[model samples]
Target: MDDGRAVISVLLADDENLIRAALRTMLDLEPDIDVVAEASTGDEALSKARAFTPDIAVLDLQMPVLDGVEVAERLREHLPNCGVVIVTSHGRPGYLKRALSVGARGFLPKTTSASTLADVIRKVAAGGRFVDPEIAAEAISAGDSPLTPREADVLEHAAEGASVEEIARRVSLTPGTTRNYLSSAVSKLGAANRYEACVIARRFGWI
Candidate 1:
């Protein structure tokens, strides 16, 4: 706590140990910021956030079990007061767009400055929002995502190198239907194949 206000409690969630350690060290330097808990996976982050009820949850965009957007959605439902900050290397307009759409209060790239990171945390803790300038610019210029929901799902599964049969089984679609979805996604994304389509879509944060 500082200036007679409650200290901003934070939950740090990232898969990388070194990244978490570095963030903890940097955040601990701020007088009004306290990292109350840390998580190595999205599920663990959710559990810790629920248990600690931190003022801010700083999460990596990609994690095991659940991604940052999924965790953010769940957090908004279960702990609306807990602000979410997506800190990721992705930094694509689509990722930023999705995070904001899902009620995340902050979206920052991993390249963000330490001071800027702290400031964003303060802003979110005070009921404000922040988005990386580069991400915002890219998002505005990138316009809308081209893939439909079903196409996006197929592409997302394909990103894992899944066979068409495997994706069909997972999505409860016939193999031929799954192949059609992949073909549609590839054409929409202007890629030569499903693998390329998945790469492009993931890079744009569309999946």
Candidate 2:
């Protein structure tokens, strides 16, 4: 427990009540770690951070109000010492890359063991780093070549539920040109469909 002089305070943010409860339980078992506060959304995490002043934040990638990437950015700007650990079910390769880009120090799958979770928390608190093994291997294998800027712009507009015509209108491009860009992006990402392309593009920071 490090003699109680130093305890790693944590702020947990997840959309599900049960998941938050479970994480609290597991972290409580560690004498040197404490759950100082809980939030259900990115906004709540940011709002409560000043009061809690937790040493670490365990956040999910997706949540209402704001997303984890934005939360991590704000934390980096406002709480420089507070480490971020992405705990999510979306184990997509793009997500892992983007999370690291956004200043997250650790990545742990939602399916990771409780012991591993505890270890990651402690390690990050003590200025160590961690990343999910599978994600690490995949990120390495992929070698990080993002789509072109125009392709990223196309994908971002498309991901926002825009139709091809609407995407053209928004991006100030001809409909046929928009379609071509979308098609090229899909091929470059090796995505089976536009939806998959959006996901891949997002992870690669193209959008």
Candidate 3:
């Protein structure tokens, strides 16, 4: 399939059609890279990844059904050989932290040029890591999150004005436990209430 050159296969997962098209076009022009599959949601991305088994996956950080960080974690568990790169418009410090923790090899903003993305893909495929310098600096300044994972989960569920019972149902926790987590999160952030906690967590990209 290649003139004695090893081509890096890539799976692109972004909900935006235009972005996908542009990326595919850009990557297709590279001699050493091939766009093997594309998906519009996180679930679809996972399914296609399983089917295609691409060498690398370039994922949008905020896909539907499951976020890119969640997808990256699943891929790490199910397809350890496939490297992951997360690109996002958000570029929040907490989001960057979560992506890296999930074993993503590359993290960059959507504003990155196509040539830069190609270089990142090449680097990640070669068992290297890359993170945008500005994002890295912001993450270092943001420090670590104070809330526990459970507490952060509850806060995220509460972000959309969900009641404690609904949050419990979504997270598979008891209503009382959900309330406790929410309270703990609020107290940790010095927020007056659950809503304020959500705002603070979101602003800091903790949720």
Report RMSD (Å) for each prediction in the order shown: 5.1, 6.8, 4.7
What's model 3's TM-score? 0.78
Residue 166 lDDT, candidate 2, scale 0-100: 93
In candidate 3, how many clashes are counted?
A: 0
Tens-place lDDT digits, model 3, residues 142-169:
7788876568777888998898998887
Best by lDDT: 3
1 or 2, greater by TM-score:
1
- Regions more than 4 Å wrong, model 3: 1-4, 147-188, 198-207
* Cα displacement (Å) at residue 169, model 3: 18
Per-residue C-alpha lDDT of model 1 across residues 1-207, encoded as one tens digit per residue: 347757899999998999999999999998889999999988999999999999999999877667788899899999999999999886656667678888999998999988999999999999899998888888787677887555777678888888889988765578998889889889988899888887888776677
In model 2, the runs with Cα more than 4 Å from the true position are 1-5, 145-207
For residue 73, what is the lDDT in candidate 3? 95
Candidate 2's error at 33, in angstroms?
A: 0.8
lDDT of 2 by residue, 93-133 (tens): 56677778878999978999888988998899889999998
**Whole-model lDDT, model 2:** 0.82
